[model samples]
Target: MLLAIDLQSETPIYTQISEAVIEGIAKGQLQKGEALPSVRTLAVDLGVNLHTVNKAYQLLKQGGYVQINRKQGVIIEPNAFPIADEAFKQRLWDRLKPAVAEGVCRGVKREEMMILLDEIYRDLNKM
Candidate 1:
């Protein structure tokens, strides 16, 4: 997985890392069964403490996005993706709600958003 952490972000480092990986998964930038870099490698790449990468891996594990193993390091555990936790779901909507509202303000219909979602789903599946 390719990642760039923003030390300048108001969000936590783990969160920055998690979101990038999750979005990469959703967008099919990282495919099922692809190996991600080890946490230490990622920390070195991002110029952050190794603990930050470990924390981010823990979050990804909690979110059911990746599997952390002693031998394989952090790897993408493909198939059977689960629904995100309720709070995370709410947080996602909180982020989307405003964008949708803005789209509505710009006269984009709700069906358009649904169609867009479908398109992205189709595209990702094609990957």
Candidate 2:
């Protein structure tokens, strides 16, 4: 899988790296059980410090999107995607509330927001 980072972005490099991997998985570019590039190799390829790559991998692990093993390196989680629990729903709402509120403040109609959400859902499913 190919990963790209924007050196000039306000987001941290580690966050960009982890998000890229997550997007790759969602886009079906990286399959479950696939091994990611080694930390040192990826750092060299991205012209970043090895610690940055390692931090990204750690984030992926904490997010349950990947697993790291001494012998196997980093691999995508093999289990099915997690179902949203109550806690997860709460967290989702917490994240979405601000964006939805911003839309409301901008005079975005509910129907327009629904259509936009539907479009995003469809695009993700298409991948």
Each model's lDDT: 0.84, 0.90
Best prediction by TM-score: 2
lDDT of 2 by residue, 3-107 (tens): 889999998999999989988887788899999999989999999999999999999998889989989999999886676789879988998999999999999
Q: What is the lDDT of residue 20 in candidate 2?
A: 92
Encode model 1's per-residue lDDT on 2-88: one tens digit a residue. 687778888999899988898788778887777789988898899899898899889988878888778877778767678677987
Ten-residue stretch with the least lDDT total in model 1: 75-84
- TM-score, prediction 2: 0.85
Candidate 2 yields a Cα-based lDDT of 0.90
Clashes of each: 0, 0
Best by lDDT: 2
lDDT of 2 at 11: 89
